[model samples]
Target: MIVSGMSGSGKSVALNTLEDLGFYCVDNLPADLLPEFVRRVMRGEDRPEKLAVGLDVRSGGDLGVIPDVLSEVGGLGLDPKLLFFDAEDDVLLRRYADTRRRHPLSHLGLALADAIALERQALKPLRQIADVVLDTSALNVHKLRRLVITEFGLGEASTLSLLFESFAYRRGVPPDADFVFDARCLPNPHWDARLRPLSGRDKDVSDYLEAQPDVVQFAGEIAQFLDTWLPRLQSDTRSYVTVAFGCTGGRHRSVYLAERLARHARERGWAEVAVHHRELD
Candidate 1:
């Protein structure tokens, strides 16, 4: 469990970063009120895999409640760590001003600066008790992302991170793809004048593309290649993968080929499948 600090302190960003690292997140929880919820979630269901939460003053200001929650966690035999995010009031103030937002504590008729100071004071007890404390004033987005990836071990991933991407020639490339192939060799139905505007999912288009022996062979080869190399790729612990398949247009041949490969991967019990048709719409 992570009980994050003040609003405008990048708590949400931290929480979301953890979520991407595969932590299920619960937000803005009161510290005093966490035992029952934690007990229920942890009991009768085993470890429930992994989970995280953001407990803070928006729910209640008594930091002492955290110790009780920790005690409950110890009693329940679930060790939950508390990470706190901190920043200079000036940095946080600038963040809020730059984003044109108000502090969560400001809703109580307090000035922004006053609210920040009050929140800091309220959370002081929690900070004294934190497992890892971060001063985010100097951490930009990249640094913050790295911190979450490093400290919580959330960013640790297997070597073979399979990325299935779909792209349009006009929109640039998929941001997270490991391997890319150009399916442009398959006959493009787009230039047929009649089929030019249709997508691969259309019955006529699917039939036409499926009729091409070359296209079937190409897809089969690609799938077979991935199967052989992916295991070794995993052994190396590669962080991300991107595969791009291009054609004259992204709609017909490339989409058909991509989907076919995806189906093959799924049938083989490979669930790390993500497919996008960059221009198929």
Candidate 2:
């Protein structure tokens, strides 16, 4: 695994989490050295079963070379995954203030905000090619740790992991979603006085939406589409796919469909199904 991201966006936390999960972790590894490092490991008699190397702006090399290096590692018969971590500019600035740690590019005499912008621009290639781009703007250390462990720790490396997330359309779509389905057209439990305070996870809300013909048909079609295409995606070597459901308020229809699809995916024999309700999490 190659971990790279904006500074102060929890690369250390992610590396630490991977370490705890038995990954032989290396931090600040230069990009040019990556292929050689992988080669040495592959030749070792007692190589670690899992390895995670950290690379970022601090690593002091051309970030653009990472993709070619990744391809070279793949040519060596190892499937390499790049995970890029990121956060909002304000969040990163606040973190630097709270921690009083210098930004990696601080030596260039740029202001903190400018350094962040420059770093974001410099890391654009890595982010675009990343198998997963984790946005930690709203995540704390503990939440980030749990997310890493849940997504990476317990799954077979060869199997594709599915993430079903529910989010409010009003808050904008999740950036990491590979597929986003709008659930706003379905029957909403929010209008019912008795179910107003209840979320989609509640039996009352589920029963209300499940009774609607539109909801049932919508869900079935989405499931059918996924059933037809998900296996093909897995066969193409995708490590993770996030399917997001969005509604006016995340508490009702969106959550219902995310939960329903997650169950459906599991029933189809996909072992790594995880459900995350963004509004409720």
Candidate 3:
């Protein structure tokens, strides 16, 4: 496992969280030494079943070397996962002020904002390579820890955790979604003046949508498609899958369909189905 991100984006907190989850944790290992480090871990007299390493700008690591090293490790049959943490610039600035700590790049005589900008540029390569990019702008340490535990903890080891999310097509697709379904062709509730101010979760909006035969049929067909294929998908090594439903406004059709799918999955004995209404959030 590799943990990297912006300077104040909680890499240390992530490492501590992993340590609590029984992973052997290392901090600030140089990028050039990663290959040799992997070798040692694999062939050492005492090998840990799980290991996590932290890397950031302070490690004197060359960003250009990471892809090659990762390829080499992959050649050796290691399935390494990278986690990138990030936050909004203003949030990062606030964190630095609260902690009263100088930025790592401040030694170059750059201002705080400039230092942060430089760090972000330097870490862009790692961010592109990450399997998970966690945004921490609104998360406190405790919340982040809980999120890490929920995402990485082995409690649901045999089950595939499913996330059904609703989004607006105007906002583009969700980056992490495994399957994206378009609902713009469905009858929209936005045109209904009575339901204009209500969300899909509201009783009035739900009633309006439920009364539409086309909407009902769309939901049923999508649910059927998932039921037919989810088992095959679960047979793969992935632990989680995200199914996104998108409409023009995300206020009615998309949200209703996403909720309906979540319920269907649960009824089918999927114990870890979750619904996320992105626009609502």
Best by lDDT: 2
- The TM-score values for the models, in the order shown, are 0.56, 0.55, 0.55
Indicate the residue-level lDDT of 59 in model 2.
86
Cα lDDT tens digits, model 2, 7-80, are 98989888877885679899998999999999998799989999999999988879899989899999988899
Q: What is the full ranking by lDDT, best candidate first?
A: 2, 3, 1
Which residue segments of model 1 deviate by more than 4 Å? 44-47, 157-281
Q: What is the lDDT of residue 276 in candidate 1?
A: 50
How high is the lDDT of residue 112 in model 2?
100
Residue 239 in candidate 1 has what lDDT?
45
lDDT of 3 at 34: 82
Write down the lDDT of every candidate, Cα atoms only. 0.71, 0.88, 0.83
* TM-score for predicted model 3 compared with the true structure: 0.55
Q: In candidate 2, which residue ranges exceed 4 Å CA deviation?
A: 153-281
lDDT (Cα, tens digit) per residue for candidate 3, span 109-160 = 9999999999999999999988999999987554565467677663446567
lDDT over C-alpha atoms for residue 131 of model 1: 93
